[model samples]
Target: MNKGVVKMDFSEEKILETALKVVKSNIAGAKVCKPVLASFAGRKGQKALTIEIRLDSVKLKYRVEIKAAVTKSDKMLLAMTNKETGLPVMLMTQYVNPEMAEELKQIGLEFIDSAGNMFINQPPVFVFIKGNKLKEPVRCAIKRAFKKAGLKLIFALLTTPGLENTTYREIAVAAGVSLGSIDYIMAELKEMGYLRRRVDNSLYLEQKDDLVRRWVMAYPEQLRPKLTLGTFRGPEKWWLHGRLPSQDTMWSGEVAAHKMTDYLHPETVTIYCRPQKLNGLLLSNRLSRDPVGNIEILEKFWNNDEKSASGELVHPLLVYADLIASGDPRNAEAAEKIYEQHILQLVR
Candidate 1:
């Protein structure tokens, strides 16, 4: 059972040939014509090719765009193809999974795969044929864009809710990642349809809840433990009343939720402090490291300006995610309250 990319080095001639065969065979009475290589204006400094074919039987021509696969990110390419050729846009590829046809249609492009599964939306003739797939199709791309650096930039956007339109350089500086990394993350978000760019080039989230849920789900599974510097046995008083690192320390988890909602009587105090002040806070509070400690010390993930200026609590979004991720019904209820008050009131 050998499985690999069937057409990694696919060429335009091969694609054009395959598409010609698929269309020729699919239409019973359609006469196949020659494939004409056509070029059109694309992104700046880039020209794109469209294979034009004349159908003698139907007396209509088709402008076929060739691609390896049509993933969600192909919206831009589809737009360019449509813009370049006012003729009906049909996509022919080496492979197309039946699942991706819907996403292609949403962007106003029709497709026919090498495997014979197809959806062509040209009018006066809407054709849909299924069940001739030769092999499992490949997904567009794989990336872990929500890891440390990406998470930092996203947290700034989601928590602040005002930096959505900020420049890439600003995001790179704040996220502490390279400009290249920011570009990658931005593409991933745009492809996922979670992030949207306005006409003014300002970016914002279309599904804010979806973004939060993804972060929260990944946080407990991945980011949370990395952030947990070391748990320690301590009283909640240090977070509430004692003299801790005032500027660098912030409370999260249950205590932070309670601060914003006042609906839950929290049993544990979740605290976050800058790394430079972590040892001092631990020494001053007489805290000892314990694997199952009541106090969780999280490494500060944001800068001073990113933290809340009016309260000791962390951002409302962080509080909500922490509580909701706890998997406790009571915590989930408190999370809703925090969402309504602090999260809604503060973040857009």
Candidate 2:
């Protein structure tokens, strides 16, 4: 009923058509052609809708993927889609949330939403517009497997060897989740094709690369926020020589990446510890409470403290997630290094 908003029952074709209209209206003299299904070779006969955009004497083509909504987890898939295709990808969606929009730009993927939010960087025609309000909320049913508690279960399964093949009671204990949460999460994962059952009634994880990518994307938003204890200020580079008060506390985020790869000088420090260990960690590092502090302390979500080779550092997965979630371009290289050196083996 609002003037700028209209209700939408989303379908891929409808979303593409609506987004095209928004692009045409916002960019003067721009022409958008009808989308046509086209197949790419060497991609196992993968097909995507192809569309051409024309502005004056210039024409650009893209393999377009139309969706009802785009979220943070889709970034890796979109980037991989572009890498696999001959042409760049231009996502046509009903809406592009601000965080997702920023992530898309960071990865150099172009998109146009029904609200006219877009980022297309081609020669002589560069248009980057964000912050457009969505015409309507996208209705999506998120599975329990991707929620916060489920993230812990997935983390345990991914990091701990043979954890998925164990009993549900054991898994629930290891993941620090309710027994009920495990049942639905496991079922949803099976339905989502992330878990495959064996003839022996055992389960194994498949598509673990994608699973980890999704986890990394979702952790900062879903789980990490729930784990924050507090923030505190410390002496500049205090972590350079400071010791953790107990083995229960470990370094994570920028500092962990620095220690793991030695490729980055951390600008901030992140610590994960049991809630009771927080005070000792602060005292050991000479940190004081500050609302906008350079150091952040979060409740350690995992039961296992032996995830890393060093007792003082968190697992590379958590470090990678923290860096990527920061949305800092400077941390991107370091994150990539950690992924290639540490994460690839676990997922592969």
Candidate 3:
């Protein structure tokens, strides 16, 4: 084999250990100077990789600063973030093709990808980890398994896992898609190793967390936009902490997220109204039709009959999905709580 697949088969700590061992095996006396996280006070972000190595190699009583990148673009971004920190670099990615690997070599930077592709060039230490070059290209679009409607099916499946034993037509209606779409979705999910078929009509979620992560990443890009009818402003009084307009509406997005977690104070309100009841909402709430408005109106995606324990709330799963999609740090934190309290409870 020209290159080996770097199994993303390890936990975070194990991945770190594997990376460190790979480095140690390559260098004569490579020892870590210290572990440090690279953060700039001026920059307003927490994603800065907490670089463990104060330096890369301490060999023969000498020291060299070593910085690290855990993702593909991470290397590029860290090249800037680590500038003031004064450290040399290492880049880790999911996979690095041989052509790209060679470019890293020419640039004189040390790197390792999850695929086991690595390169290091410090004085008295020259190493290269050339993994299986990608034989085929990767598609830019999401797999058919994660298209707009498929997300809804996945959401419904997780929220109400019993759907695993139900009919495909039932899943189709619940997901707001057609029967053919469900077939393609189920097949693709099986091939991806996230689902398994039972002797009966049942289909099961195999890798629940991984599947949810994939769905969360796609929902904002593929599903949410399609569900959104428009963004508009509503009367502020309607969004008080425990009160919402009561006409066939369900609370969602940041408003719902805040209520669940108490971790964030929300400035936006997102709600779903049944298509048949949209006119009544517009008239009753006097909601304006603004493209940039905070109040978003979505036609319900799942079973309209599905009600929250409280009639005015959307399912916590939807609330979690919306918070994660916001890509805001505070909202993202709140999303985790919704996932833990609501989604996990449902699965259990």
Top lDDT model:
2
List CA RMSD, all candidates: 13.7, 7.1, 11.3
Which window of 10 residues has the lowest lDDT sum in candidate 1? 1-10
TM-score (C-alpha) between model 3 and the true structure: 0.61
lDDT of 2 by residue, 1-348 (tens): 221111222365567777788878999999998876666541434344589899999998998766555554456546655776788889887778788888888889999998879999888889989898976755544456768889999988888878888889989988889988898999877765678877888888876765786687667667888999998998888999988987778899899998888889998888888999888888777899999988888888877444687778887888888887676667877877887788878876
Off by over 4 Å in 2: 1-107, 121-133
Cα lDDT tens digits, model 3, 216-312, are 6567767778877788877775676433445457888888876667777888888887777777677767778888888888878877245567677
List per-prediction Cα lDDT, in the order shown.
Answer: 0.63, 0.78, 0.60
Q: Rank by TM-score, descending?
A: 2, 3, 1
lDDT tens per residue, model 1, 122-222: 55666787657756443433245557767777777776555757788877776556778888887777766667767887776755643554565455544
The lDDT ranking, best first, is 2, 1, 3
Question: On a 0 to 100 scale, what is the lDDT of residue 135 in model 3?
Answer: 33
TM-score, predicted candidate 2 vs. hidden true structure: 0.76
Candidate no. 1 TM-score: 0.56
